[model samples]
Target chain A: MESLFTWNFASEIVLSTFRMATPLLLVALAELYSERAGLVNIGLDGIMSFGALAGFMISYLTGNPFLGILAGALGGVLVNMVYAFCTVTLCAEQTVYGMALNIFAPAISAFIYRVYFGVSSTLAQATLMKTIAIPVLKDIPFIGPLLFNQTPMVYFAYLMVPFTAVFFNRTKAGLSYKSVGEYPKAAETLGINVVRQKYVACIICGLLAGIGGAYLTTCYVNTYSDGIVAGRGFIALSAVIFGHWTGSGVLMACLLFGFCDALQLKLQIISKDTPYQLFQMIPYVCTLAALAIMGAKKAGPKAKGKPYLREER
Target chain B: MKLGGKSENIIIPLIAVILAFLIGGVIIAALGSNPVDAVGYLVQGAFGSKTNIGATLVKVTPLIFTGLCACFAYRCGVFNLGGEGQFIMGAVTAVWVTVSWGLEGPLACAAALLLGAVAGGIWGAIPGILKVFRGLNEMIVSIMLNYVATLFMGWVYTELLRDGSVPQTFPVPDASKLGRLMPGMRATWGLVIAVLIAAGIYYFLFNTSKGFQLRAVGLNATASRYQGFNVKRYMLFSFIVSGAIAGLGGAIELVGTQFRLMSGFALGFGFDGVAIALIAQLNPLATVLVAYFFAVLRTGATTMQVGSGVPTSVIDIIQALVIIFAVAGMAFVRLPGFKQRMLNRQRGKKEE
Candidate 1:
């Protein structure tokens, strides 16, 4: 146990935490945008599934990871439009539409994948994004190897943290966007296009979630499997709540979940006697604990799950 | 054209179903298969023979329970998304009772079922208690419990209850297995039990004053509270009852058909239940019919795959499309313009 807590093992765990947390961070940010705009989309998992397939297939066919990422974001936007139209235009229940998409998107994605690739014993592979080590940053002792030595997408996710914080706290457009969520009727009276703002939020949420899904196929793993996105999408949703809907808070929450995930994976490899299934349950259990501990007092946007209508007084 | 409130409810869902099938046909054609032939095969496969109908009914059994679970919860304005978890825990507990306890005969079966319902109720109460006492979001908590329950079940089968070389629980005693409806049929008494439960739920929701209070709380909690209703207790009750239903379904599946706990048991039935309940507009009796419809689609998909080379996943797409259309159509009918148009049409007909 003492040997296990060495500097090398610690560094490895830290690195894996960042690696595992990347997708969660991205998806949580995506959820943050949607929740802030007063639309709660619980269908992130389905969007990610679609994005993963689109990213993998595009990368496989074109031999370009960048193109795959682009395709993934586009695919996510396409699927989210269905959700946006149903919840935003039709004024339907947001959670119901979100849940419907969760079922719909994954089935359609799997269907499209089978049509393109057919069933085969061997899994198809895609080109993975290459990791780049920053020159001077890499030489900064402990922090350098832990953070600087990573794929481009990982850096992009970290960069989004500060950008999102500034966008939510500082920008004028951001204020208008948030107002729609808090008081859509008031926002409309003030000349803000509430429906347009919601549509835009859905698009951004879908794009980011898609990129997160793409990262799994094009950077983390070169192959796509059914249910590959797993429950990370839902975990990200919990992170948004755990973090209190703040960008930095979400980042910390995601990192904590990632750490748990990484530790479980490592433990499974090292210990044979212990049931690996118990280890696998750590992240989900942690998510529940985090949500319960957070105490849902001031959870999110006031109008968050309520359908907005322009015609209603 | 004359869209009264009652007629609109029935018409909208029917239109949604027709639209979903039309879109599904287009998808089949796109996949280079004859859509008409595929539909024909699908219908024939689901109801052509006694054996096929029995298989379809068998598939419908668990779905009816899960659908009723969602129906009950949603009627009380609670979203019990942990039906899958509750179902799993019930199956696990039933297996523990039957195999470990070495129980046999009808009494053993009854005990296993009872214990399974209790286990499921406890599993569901966690989310309810958290939501009521701690003010946690039940949706996320329930979803998290799903993962935990699945993992726990995995541990049970792989490590705790491993039978021989295979990663499954020991089979229940033959005497404890549920008797089939017919000697050679796959369908068991589970279907009758499910249908009877549906009727019980319908009666409860429609007739009882307690059920009225629950639905009243769902419709408007503030109003119900003002009228002297215990909103939180109703919410918790819905969760427990919903969980027990799902748990009972799991045990039934085990004794009635599966007879052993294995991987991939009762997969996707929970979400399918949610979809079915929503499509049925939260009516318990309607849920049974919708579950049967979904079962027909599911059971037929395999035969359709064999006959036309179109993948069974097309049915999933159709089911999802039905949900989207149904909700959207319901929302559309509620729009002011549509309502006005219907009113105007009715007035014109009256004058004429």
Candidate 2:
């Protein structure tokens, strides 16, 4: 098996990195729509937390992993619905409401978990999805099985890239959505339902982010743990910004991060260049550096934080 | 633009408090706990018994410091998440200094506080310098620093500062221990010191020329720079002070209450103070009330659990709900009605 080539190592890194980046990619794409319309979904962390809980709970109950992913996505949407209703409809401060939702997330999820599984010292693990290798691709040495083989969720993640790309670039509605993000007043003047478009965008962010959370629980960890979402959502947010709000850009950034995180883990195991925790800090620090660098590079949305009012200046 | 002097701004905050408590009561009831009994236990546990009250005050002492850390940044439109890390580093550095030197009570405390402040100041200055020199955003940098600080503290606990005696550092010598407030409560004079610090910060922030410049820079840094002030330097100094204040909070918690640093010993303490700062709407004086309220909720969660068989998670739920409502600005009434008649009359008298 010629999987030992330097390029093979690099290609293999991208392959597995895709698996790791799937959840963040999905969530970042979700955020791309809402953020474009001047809303920040800081509660994406909470949403992922709740989604992980929901996904795990549903999978444990139904014994079917697909439905679990759906439930997780729905769970994310439910929280985002609260966020959307508060910030978009009730005209609350988006940041505050979003942060509060982040707080509310673990509180609610833990409360419910305690209610259902009271006094249990440990949680029961759920069923994990098996990796399916394509028949012909399975025999192609290192490149074949490695590239073609993965769980259903992994393929779904790849599908989402082109799906979102097409949705954003090729569709008339996508242009209308971008118009709302760019200038809601102008969009409204041209007869687009600016408020509706924003609501749709926020809802989509919620749904996809939930699926992202599900991917973490079912495909990766396969069991729920305290603070299981960890800091992945923040890493994903960094990816989105690094990607410059484009689908390919987000995926590539996430792959870079996944490689950094994975390489850190692997490197710490082999060498004593730095402690594992110190190496772990690299990903977050890189996020900060990337954000600062990008801030100086180019302009993003014209209206990022300003809420558009149909009647007001 | 006048906004009816400074007194009117107080109403929205007052309303936020009343609404938070009333909703908190409902939450307890929904959890199958008697709201009255929950409040009773909270009061009794926190204040009715002298020992518990002292414990509460001791807890509040450090929280007050962290709360002020957040309060300073809000006046400048920046939210700092690195307080937790900064606070822990402050404690570690202070404890290390205390062990290195043998001094009596007040001298050791002062030395520890100063050293801790400088440690926190340096750590906090990283983001500050980045924001000033490299045009970095403080919010992202602060969040990143939080992880770094937390990991650094965790590393200290495990490697450099590990103690075999117990899970924490060795007992600070009697000379290093903060003196008690009175004979009864285990609460130390840290409360008094915290109050003094708060008053000092209040005067510095509300009255001093430096405080005014910081606030001006916070309100609009570019405009302030155009007026020929050292905007970046002031901004950098702002984080140094904020981080120092937060560091002192950690020192107080360790020296006054905990007496040794350990894992999860002060878990969520810094973030709790952040919630208090927000609920207090960046008012240093009001931070006491908000911090106390949260402390009581944390103290009372146990009793609420024992009494009604409700999971203690309900208290967390209530705290989250209160934060949600506060941040959403849901509790604020932009328009004041006849309901605030008594407050209006009191303000009317104050204006004279």
Candidate 3:
């Protein structure tokens, strides 16, 4: 028990927390945009799984992790195009399509992998993104090693944090995007193309989620496995809700969730007698608690989960 | 035109199914397997023998329960995604009783079944009450609860119930086992129970005044509230009933087939319930047929893999495609000229 409070353990927890939080950050950012644009894209888990598979497969074939990232986003676009077509264009039930895609995408990815690589084959080896430390920044105290010495995606994710803030708060396209979510009819009256805004938002959402998936495969795990995404996509969406759809708020939410995730993994190792299942449940329990506390007062998009039929108005 | 509307409802789903199979064929062909032979093997495997048919029926039994669960909540305007959790808790509680209490005979079976329903009902009611009181999104809450329930159940099995080599609980007492309808196959009295419950729910939903009020709440809560219906109460009731039905699915799968609680035994069945309900368009009776159809595809999946060397996940792709096309109102993909002509016809009718 005395050793449990050691600085060695504390630093490990802090470092792993950032690593665990990266995928959630990217995915939450994706869902943030889509939800802001009046679409409930809860199918991020499935989309992420597809992205992970495609990224891994491409990196395995080309030996280029950068190309893996690009292909991963493209994979996400292809899948979300179906979702955008159904929910945005055809005005299908958003929840139903999202749910179906959650099941469908992962199964298809797994099936393709199995067909190509056979069920008995070992995990494919691929080039993993190496840790890149920002030289001057790395010399600083506690925050330096924690934030500066990390993978390229980690730096990219942090940069996007501020980028998203500027994108949403100051940009014209972003303002129009928010308007489409708030009141599509009003936005239409104001000369904003509501459908077009939604389509772009949904596509961008997929692209970001794809990067999240690619990061999981090429940076963290370096091999594709079933369940690699493992509900991070869903957790990320919950973070979006917990943050009340703000960029900084989502960052805090993802950090909190990442802390819980990292704590669970650490506790399982340090405390052997405890039921590991209880430790495994921490992140999910946190999500439920956050939703319960924040849900009632949430100020989400007004036209969310509803189809926009221009002629009906 | 009225008759045409009803027929289109049937026609659209059929078209979606056919289109899914055709696309699936293309996928199979891309994988270098003969699509025709693969589908043939799938059909034959699902219905080749009495035993095969019985296995398919056994699969349908649980699906019916889960489908009805989704159907009930969907009709009341609730999306109860916690079928997986409710089902898991139901299986855990049912198995816990059988192992700890050591009940036997038909009376024991009744107790196990009743206890399973109650456990599931309580689990179901949690999210339902939360939605009404706390204004949380039931969909998100329910999905979270699924993980909690799954993890909790895993903890229970590891810490308490598991005393042997396997992670599952000890088998339920033979005396409490569901009676087999076929000696060699897995089909049991649960199938009859499923059918009767489906008919009962159909009667409750379409024929009874309370059911009408529930439907009214689903269709127009504001209007129902104006007419003095308790919208919140009905919504809660819908969720509880939906949970109970899904829980019963877990319980039936436990006593009727698996005879023990194992992690992931009921993994995708809950989502499969969503698919079934959607395909049936939330009709209770239609769920029976849809559940069976899904069951055939599921039960035949292994055979499809064996015969075609194509992964059985092809079924999942087909089901997803079916749901998308069936729900998406495939109206905008027509040729430009055709779409223009249709628009002109609509305008002409409006002018007339």
Q: Which prediction has the highest DockQ against the true structure?
A: 1
lDDT of 1 by residue, B231-349 (tens): 99999999999999999898888888888887888778888999999999999999999999999999899999999999888999999999999989998887777788889988988
Alpha-carbon TM-score of each model against the true structure: 0.98, 0.88, 0.95
lDDT of 3 at A260: 91
Cα lDDT tens digits for candidate 2, B275-313: 778777777888877777777766666655665566777
Go through the candidates in order and give each one's DockQ.
0.79, 0.44, 0.59
Q: Interface-residue RMSD per candidate?
A: 1.0, 3.1, 3.2
Candidate 3 on B81-193: residue-level lDDT in tens? 88888888888877877777867777767777778888888889988998888887788778878888888888876767885987877888888887898689889999999
**For model 3 chain B, the run of ten residues with the poorest summed lDDT:** B329-338
Query: In candidate 1, which residue pairs get closer than 3 Å at backbone N, Cα or C atoms, i.e. clash?
Result: none
User: Model 1 over residues A1-313: C-alpha lDDT tens digits?
Assistant: 4557888888988999999999999999999999999999999998999999999999999999999999999999998999999889888888788889888988988888777777554788889998899899999987997899999899999999999999988999888988988989999999999999999999999999999999899999999887788788899998998888889999999999999999999888778799999999999998888877777777678999998977777
lDDT of 2 by residue, A24-125 (tens): 777787777777776777778789888888998898898878888998999998989888876776566666666666678877888877877785657677
